[model samples]
Target: MALHLPQAASLPFGSLTKMLPLNKTSSSVSAISKSFNATTSLKIQCKAPSVIVSDQSQQVSRRSGDFKPDVWHYDYIKSLDNNYKEHAYEEESRMLRAEVRVFLSDTVNPLQQLELIDTLQRLGLAYHFKSEINKMLENIYSVDKFKNKQNLHATALEFRLSRQHGYDIPTDVFDSFINDEGDFQTSLSQDIKGMLSLYEASFLLMEDETILEKATDFTSKSLRDFMSRNPGHELTSQVKHAMEVPLHWRLPRWEARWFISEYERMPNMNSNLLQLAKLDYNMLQAMYQEEVKSNIRWWERTGLEEKINFYRCRVVDNYLWGLGMKEEPHVEKLRRVIGNLCAIITLTDDMYDVHGTLDELELFTEAILSGKISVRHLGLRPDGTMVEKRQA
Candidate 1:
């Protein structure tokens, strides 16, 4: 149960001391801020908007390629849909477990294993499946019922529900690792890698028409339910608009195609929709910036504040140098975004640990600070609107 994991140069896990430290400003970050301002201030050429004003009659005749088709090509779409329904999850799940087994057993070829890892990652199981994989790894080495295929599958399900992080695990499986405490780090590293893989997997799912459709349907239904529950509220419109606009405007044709395909396959509109909505909002700003870069004055007027906030929200002092990645424009921007994200995560995680190990709290915080989190009436508190309480 205990293996001395090669001490990874202690990763900056939840900071106890630094979370609320003094002056809280480092000189290095200040310099970076000054440089960032100077660079952004440089005069750059802007592009003109693609649309041109024309006569009404001519405009009527001129078809913009913006119209989304009500249905996809029936024949081809049907066959693809049938295939997804028949296969996608079962294949991905089996393949994922197999890949982890191979890694733990040290039986599979490294290159082949990595490819399998990449596939599971692309499929979006990387993180969810990983915690279970680590559990399985321990089981393989320890005394838990690995021979029982049902147990293995149960482990897989627990992982999906966020139980692998010690939520609703079987006592035997949980205690098995407790016996061998040394391998904990290796288990955790595997878990992290797995989560990373799932994050990538989500992107892969994002591109699949079938997956995207299921997600959208799910989001739409959730919105409908939310609205039904709340009779009338001003914020409802804003939330609804946020959900719909991204689905209609921000989601591209390619993603739409995948959404349709996914809908055909899974046909369930569960959490996928929320994930898609979040992804849409997060990526849209970047896409919008790229789209409007040509019109200098327009860019200055519309985009400057957004760009500044985007960077400001993400900037963190430690984020710039940690992880050994080189500093550059995009890197700097990404670091800031990640920093902002982590700050929110760190703050909320404290609450989660205290309140209830609420997985959605992390996801919700992720959504909120990333501009995706929305809340509605459970009722009002004395101070303000009744918001979902975090641990704090």
Candidate 2:
């Protein structure tokens, strides 16, 4: 390789060879040392090339996250109160669920069955009826009842629900919706119910499904226009909600919370199902409330805030996890155990990754292995008794 350099530039070796070839000290290397120091001190300071900045680039970065820290002066969570205990609604909940199942069993039309399944899923009560729902869906798909309906709303509904439940339906079923102009039929825009159903259905598309890609673009525009024209209509809010976040992507608990309110407003809403849902939610929420208290207390007494820096308190993290493990009466006990485990593990991980020294780690390991670490303190104590403490 050929060396390239600016012709006027000087290299450090330019002087180094000159000095090295002609150096001798008169006073026992002192003169040579001084000369060497002086030569090296002649620094060739490198200047970084300046970058040009536009006026817009330096003002501020856009906000990346909306998370805010807890701001209360006292222990707001622990100091606050809840009055709920376990409910005696197990028997009642069972009865209501049985009645709803009876209602489902009596319904036979495929389209009607799909509507019930769809509504139950959206309402988040579908978890209770999984076996029955699957049996109905299986029969409907095996008989090819999906194609028996020509109505766009019913076809889209069947297509979406079937695909969602893991049945394979042809993407070509949607070709009927495209007009001679090679776009989604503009006349079909008036079918807002079908449009919304199609919009939800479009999300189930596979990679090569260009028809669904067009359907997504078409339905989005159509729905946005519908929202503007009929802002006061009953379906407007639903359209807006579905456009923002699809049903499959929503957290089941939050979806249930949102849907329960919507379900209550329906004139034909089943009283037993509605009552069961509300009671179930309230009782489950109370369990979460209890778990949150346990976690916050564990976090505080561990002195995690003083010991750790910048790590989140993680009370919310623990509670959300515990809420996901819905095991009823034993769930409270499980939550406390698991919440403590998570808090310890999280802080311990941060310590090992970021703040711990080799010496501190050695001590931590020894303490744990030797049983000197108590449930309350898990602290590294060398000269103290290795007491096998029971859990706090």
| Number of backbone-clashing residue pairs for each candidate, in the order shown | 36, 0
**What is the Cα-based TM-score of model 1?**
0.18
For residues 1-392, write the lDDT of model 2, one tens digit per residue. 11111111222221111111101321111221111222333322111113322325544222212223432222433443432232344565577688899999998998889888887876667878989999998998888765634567878888888898888898777667777776788887888988998898888888899888888899999999999999988888778888877765555555666677677677778766666665565445555655666566556655656653534345545445544454345546666666566656755665565445577778988987897764547331232211243599
Q: Candidate 2, after superposition: displacement of residue 242 in Å? A: 1.1
Q: Rate the local accuracy (lDDT) of all candidates.
A: 0.30, 0.62
Per-residue alpha-carbon lDDT of model 1 for 1-392, expressed as tens digits?
Answer: 11111112332211100111111142111111110112223222222123432436534322122222112121221122111122333443344355545444563433233333333332233443565445443443344223233232233223322232233333233222222432211232223222222222222232333432433344345445555665565335433433444322222322322232233234232233223322222232232222212111222333323422211111122232222232222343443334333434433443354322246466766776785533222122323222334666
Candidate 1's C-alpha runs over 4 A off are: 1-119, 122-172, 180-299, 302-392
Q: After best superposition, candidate 2 residue 54: deviation in angstroms?
A: 34
TM-score of each: 0.18, 0.65
For model 2, the stretches where C-alpha displacement exceeds 4 angstroms are 1-68, 71-87, 180-182, 321-392
Best by TM-score: 2
RMSD of each: 26.6, 26.0
